[model samples]
Target: MPDVQDCLPTALYRAAQVRELDARLIAAGTPGFELMQRAARAAWRALRRHWPQADEVTVLAGRGNNAGDGYLLAALAQRAGWRVRVLAVGDPAQLGGDAALACAEARAAGVAILPWSECAPLTGVLVDALLGTGLSGAVREPYAQAIRLLNASGQPVLAVDIPSGLCADTGRVLGVAVRAELTVTFIGLKLGLFCLDGPDHCGALAFADLQADPRLLATGVPAAQRLTGAGLPALAPRPRNGHKGLFGHVLVVGGDSGFGGAALLAAESCLRSGAGLVSLATRGEYVAALLARRPEVMARGVRSANEIQDLAAAADVLVLGPGIGQGAWARSLLSGLGALDKPQVWDADALNLLAAGQLTAPAGNWLVTPHPGEAARLLGTTTAAVQADRPAAALALARQLNALVVLKGLGSLVATPSGELYLCDRGHPAMAGAGLGDVLAGLLGALLAQGLTMTAAAQLGVWLHACAGERLGRAGRGLVAADLMTSIRDLLEEHSPCLK
Candidate 1:
């Protein structure tokens, strides 16, 4: 995804989670103001590195600690002989605690402090310190006007911590969010900044620990994780004596009457992704067509559940629901296949059926891939609600179904029942076409059959799929499902598991 970096000592955390951790660290003997100063230094370091030659800086300060970080960064910029100005959105008299201290520091550094007005000239690189993790509702009044101006200013922006008005847990924009060219987050990475609107709002993300004792984080659980190729564990190299049987069998059940292309896409993706054997269970009408298209796949068509029992029973990983309608045949096949104990990936109509309460997912070893609409159906909510807080929706779905959840979107989020959350920022808009979900299901299924853990398989599969889509998109539009197969194969070989 978006250029994965080395593992941050600080794992991703939600606003409340990080706030609690901050309190714990203070109770454990570190001063609150000290931590704030550390955060300021970290943000300042990042700002200098990103815009080394930009001497003029403008800071948009609010009432919260996020504003304090901005003021501190302004003070640092002033000390370094860069002309800096702080446009205070909050009454300076209302500032308290470390925020007040940061204000005094900025004033002492000879940085100009101006009260915010409708026509203030916000020049140079704008620093978004207007709001922080504590935001819960829509942006109001002067701040909204100020944010609107900052966005329209066209100057490069470096946000202190998260972008203003973005929910640190859900990545939802509270009416409006400041678009920063770069965001330097401290203490812990906010999970929201990497999902939903996160990737679009926060550009070129950087994380700093603020030198907090690592053990302090152990006291608080993470809200989510940002997946990186470097963070993924390596898959074993193919054994010299490996046989077709050792790689395991995959059963792809779907492709109802006019939708044969969906099932074929999944089956072909599985084959290309290294599944030793891939069997497609579809309408009998398409058997000849499937065989002619992909001869390597064992294409079998079935009219009833009994006809596909042996096939499902033989599979190590079951990829169900691509092109599956809610019709009698689709229901019969899914109902029969759900009884198997193998790891499974349920996508397309399978998810719709699950959401409709027509089918129950097996207890474990399953992944549910749903776009916002499908996820909303499964969660018994609306698509807006799902998109407003994707990270929460993903984790909630995972917990409710006891299955890994892959909520696909701008920044796809993968969540597990145990509360592990990952954001994949590696996809391109060209992947918005049909049949992509089927390909994802096949890739995930193939990885699972190869013995990767559910989380690992989901992570690797998402990374591979997104990276391939990005590469292919560079070749321009009208990419078909078949085009992904070759790109995926090439990417896997180039990536070589966890290496590089």
Candidate 2:
């Protein structure tokens, strides 16, 4: 239901924070059961809209307020004359507060209530109310079994509030989480719904306000911001008399031997994304081919670090580490960069070398782009650990490295050294290929050379890069990295035009 960008809340919250917001709303004159009722009504409306042809509904419920939502939905379905069944995963006798009241109402409405077992047959639209924001620790026993069975069921699933067994704050699956076709969340949008494993488990997202007071809802600071177009900081349009000298020069340093195309890809992105002057300091063998391919980029062959000195001095920014191998040659070029006072966008092998302790960040502006594997290596942990809590991992990388860090993957996170974070929820599954990071590295450098601060460059660059991928990704899978360059330039012009 995601509603619309303007209607959907821009800020994302932790599960605890959303729960706190709920408590605040309840304390401010709305009854708890009434809020539960609103959630049920909201969910019911969404369910009917999504599955209007379905005449039967299966509700999986637990013991908390989450289960209360299931019971309330069952009542709504029963009143509407839909054949409804409520399978209680948690004991009904243990229902407390609003949940017990909801159960009584459902029973009064003649909704069939049944105890859940491993073998219960699932049919029609299924509602997941087995767990909510209150979940922590791994799901145990019957709850785990229930989630497994729900996932195994092929019926269209609609998660109530949050998917059962999904961590509302981190989006981590607690051992296992219910996979739903559509997830409807209330009050505030939570972070777990956007990042890490959140996007995978949540089929499609819809948000509801439950008609809460706008003034009251604006109480606390949000956990992170969604990197939507409206929220992105603008790259001011260039003047009519803009010249190449006015915009900074960008030197792309990589393409070790066989990986020459990687460096060329980044250089192409830099030139296309409006970098004033783009240079390529790469393998000697590739110079002839690169000049033929992209003559706009000043191509040079630098066998040793010394060969790059003159080019590096004239450069305004460096796009480093696309296919830069970890051998003596790459190390020498890295050594050459150690003393340069220029902005740098590090990616690919640069991150890999950093993880291996072969190189340190050069003296100047810095932005590091790493996928989950690289991020894990940077943090000296496992990729699984990095993904489990993406926000924490992004922040840790930012603080530890003392640079602007972009942890690239699904729900890419851009974090500043000071701890500010932005989440990019855009992009497509077709981006699961190589050379994408190289394109991103060059784009970031181009933005930085155009005069955006390290943090702002990261945010805007990441948005443009992902938006480009999302555009071409619609053609389906097998998307090549180079396919995104033209779209990247177009999107950049659309957002922050060179000609106003």
Candidate 3:
């Protein structure tokens, strides 16, 4: 299990919440300057650790506390006799309080402070301290150009906190954002640094507590939970006396004719993930292929609705819509399955069908995983709108469908109908390939069959799937869904404790 250092708070607060925490800490006797100094030192330590040999450091300082952090970091570098320069992006005279003190300290340490200029010769490491999480609107004027130049510098950049033009509440980039190779965030873990463009812009992320009182931090609200593998639910190992029927059955519906691989992948996930009985109802043409791939799964080649009725009736869990296309045959099959009141995990075209108003989501324990575009369709909005506010969008879908909704993205959000929300930030970008969602749906269905509730199944399934992606992603690109199954079993084995 990974350390709980990443788990800060589940409630993502605005920039004001962080400020309030700072104020509360100061009010409780800790001097504001002391806290600022701690943050600077924390960032400096991370900087040195990340770029040990880089002697030249360009600190782009603004007029706020964030700049104070940059200035102090520059002072630390200068004191070490490293070639450090503070390219003040904002008016240096405008800096006040601890920030002003930090600037004076940097100057005293022989770190040259210069005004923002195109000819500043930004070489080596560029530290972005221009706009913090406080900025709400699009980055304007000189700052925007500065961000552009910093991005073009090709020098490995480090953002002081959140990236310059990213919304701290939502990971949405404020028009343009600086892409940092490393981002050292302080105080509390901001939610915006994990979702949307946050993952892309924040590169390798590091967090510091600034040695603030944990009690004061407890009083502060969290903006969002950072999902890792630490808090995942454990599936106990099967006992010697356990039988195949004890684990429950999972029925997958999809793969009309030519798209049989989708259903096969879903069934395979369920079969491998510990489902006692795994079955697939698909086109007859694919039956031999599915059996050839995994003989354990009971593959039924169903061309009509009648061929699936009995199977749907007996399924402990149903995985719907992985390549079930929107044709008449697909519609007829789903319509029949929708009438059955069983636990379901819907994905891919099934979600698309619901978004298109072709059918209503069936009642009972259900989980729906949709990407941003499908989520937008479900919410009757554009994909941009959905991406801008994913947390809200996930909640809305959960309420509308009366099911667990997993909004798939950088930080996958799982929202239950009961207003409960869970986040899974464990996957790698290599999992962005095809058949991944099918694998997720099958895993979730297997969990449901194994007696986990809709929410638990969804959350656990997401964590397992994402963690597998992260583990296998080390090989980089061209990660196939099948590669994750065995690795997932290995992880599950490490997680599950078996008593002799």
Q: Say which candidate scores most in lDDT.
A: 2
- How do the residues 320-412 of candidate 1 rate in per-residue lDDT, one tens digit apiece? 999979998998888866767889999999999888878878968889899999999988999999998888898899999999999998878
For residue 83, model 1's alpha carbon misses the true position, in angstroms, by 2.2
Tens-digit lDDT track for model 2 on 1-500? 12135556788999888888899999999999999999999999999888879888999999999999999999999998898999999999999999999999999999989999888878889999998988889999899998888898888999999898899988898999999999999999999998878988988888889999988889977888888877677788888888999888999999998999999999998988888999999998999999998999899888888898888899999888999998999988887585677888889888888889888776546889999999999999999999989999999999888888999988899998887889888888899998999999998988898899998899899989888988898899989999999998888777776666
Candidate lDDT (C-alpha), each: 0.86, 0.89, 0.84
lDDT of 3 by residue, 378-484 (tens): 98999999999787788888898887899998889988777766777678889989898888888888888888877777777888888889889989999998888
Candidate 1's C-alpha runs over 4 A off are 1-3, 7-10, 494-500
Residue 412 C-alpha lDDT in model 2: 92
Ranking by TM-score: 2, 1, 3
TM-score against truth, every candidate: 0.93, 0.96, 0.93
lDDT of 2: 0.89
Poorest 10 consecutive residues of model 3 by lDDT?
1-10
Sequence-dependent TM-score of model 3: 0.93
Using lDDT as the yardstick, the better of models 2 and 3 is 2
Error of 3 at 275 (Å): 0.2
lDDT measured at residue 192 in model 3 versus the true structure, 0 to 100: 80
Against the correct fold, how does model 1 do in TM-score? 0.93
**In candidate 3, which residue pairs get closer than 3 Å at backbone N, Cα or C atoms, i.e. clash?**
11-222, 11-223, 12-222, 12-223, 12-224, 13-223
